[model samples]
Target: MKATTLITVLLGTGSLLGLAGCADPVPEEPVPAPIPSVTPAPMPPKTPLQASHALFDETNLRTSNTVPTGGAAFLAGLEAAGFAADTLETTTDLTSVGLKAPSIQFAALVDSTCLIGQYGPGDTGYRSVIVAPLVTGGCLVGESHR
Candidate 1:
């Protein structure tokens, strides 16, 4: 409202606006570069030998103490793991005298190899072997239950 005071305020405001343009620029932080995307390589298929052992272990034959050793569950496990039913040979769960056998022998014929496996009542564990097919065009010998 006072003439001299008003002029002084205007000069101060104008001087600040003029100095603002001459001020130093603010610094900016540097940004990191983006990472490149990667595609993983596909895994190779498991060999028949590996598959046979995997099937045996996956079915829990190593620790199975009951009839599953020579029972349908064991065979079903093999079949479910891509072993054809026709390619499997197994021994009878019961002996000739109608008793549980000490152990059961089974085989899964894959390609030209037969993965022979055995599991008993107290099998510490069972490991399958990769062997050639029998002369009879099957994996097992003597009388097999299929």
Candidate 2:
């Protein structure tokens, strides 16, 4: 063919070979190490009186069914939670004039301390507290059921 065409073909072939030899080699990626799993420790057991707080919440949540309403339900919850009837006390369901009492106060005497709780209607809600025994050596005074 022509001289210029032959020279162009030779130059193009030489450039391709030169570029191939000048390229750098690719590097390989390193493998990662494995991770270890960790476990948590267990907690110690609680006393019967200390467990009463949790039982009270459980009883309060399921009111009006499974157990009778008002003070008896709370007493049942306390009894089921390891309290004996002799150790329990509560306010009367009715006032001396025969009107319904607004709320009921109950207590479980553990040694000198009283684990006291007051349960009422939806508007009044419920509360539990740790209180000292009264002067007469009991929790409730005035009119009470036991």
Candidate 3:
């Protein structure tokens, strides 16, 4: 009887050990971090004169199709933008030699800068508009007409 009881106890212990070894292990999952959001700043619009100056620079005046041709309207626009009008001259002298149409030269001085614009006769529009720093009196090249 004692042998039988010892045998039964041993069998019970072996079964428990086998069951533990055959069980599968569960792995723990990792947590993810949250991301942050950001916003950009706004910019201001350019003034009339500033816009005009930018257009002139971008187009180089010679190749631009947007610049206004010479007339009362052109002078008025410049004057309204705080530019002091000089004089309007009608001549082909200031224009490129290839263009036979007489051009009207429009000149203005604003904030120590001289703006010279040349427009062809009729509806031919602008030939060029040059911006230069003012010297002792005015722009060295675009100031006078001869």
Model 3, runs deviating above 4 Å:
1-44, 47-77, 80-82, 86-101, 122-124, 127-130, 134-136, 140-146
Flag the better candidate by lDDT, 1 or 3. Answer: 1
Instruction: Give the C-alpha lDDT of model 1.
Output: 0.74
Q: Estimate every model's Cα lDDT from 0 to 1.
A: 0.74, 0.74, 0.53
Give per-residue CA lDDT, model 1, range 1-146, as digits (tens): 59999999999999999999899988788788898898888888997668666776666463354444555656776777677898878878888899887877788787778878877654445655778897888988777866
91 Cα displacement, candidate 1 (Å): 0.4
Provide TM-scores for the models: 0.57, 0.58, 0.35
Q: Write the per-residue lDDT of candidate 2 for residues 84-115, one digit (tens) a residue.
A: 78878888777779898787788888767787
* Candidate 3 residue pairs that clash: none
Runs in model 2 lying further than 4 Å from the true structure: 1-49, 60-68
Where is model 2 poorest over a 10-residue stretch in terms of lDDT? 59-68
Report backbone clashes per prediction: 0, 0, 0
Instruction: Report residue 145 deviation for candidate 1 (angstroms).
Output: 1.7
Better of 2 and 3 by TM-score: 2
Q: How much is 98 displaced in model 1, in angstroms?
A: 2.3
* Superposition TM-score, candidate 3 onto the true structure: 0.35
Pairs in clash, predicted candidate 2: none
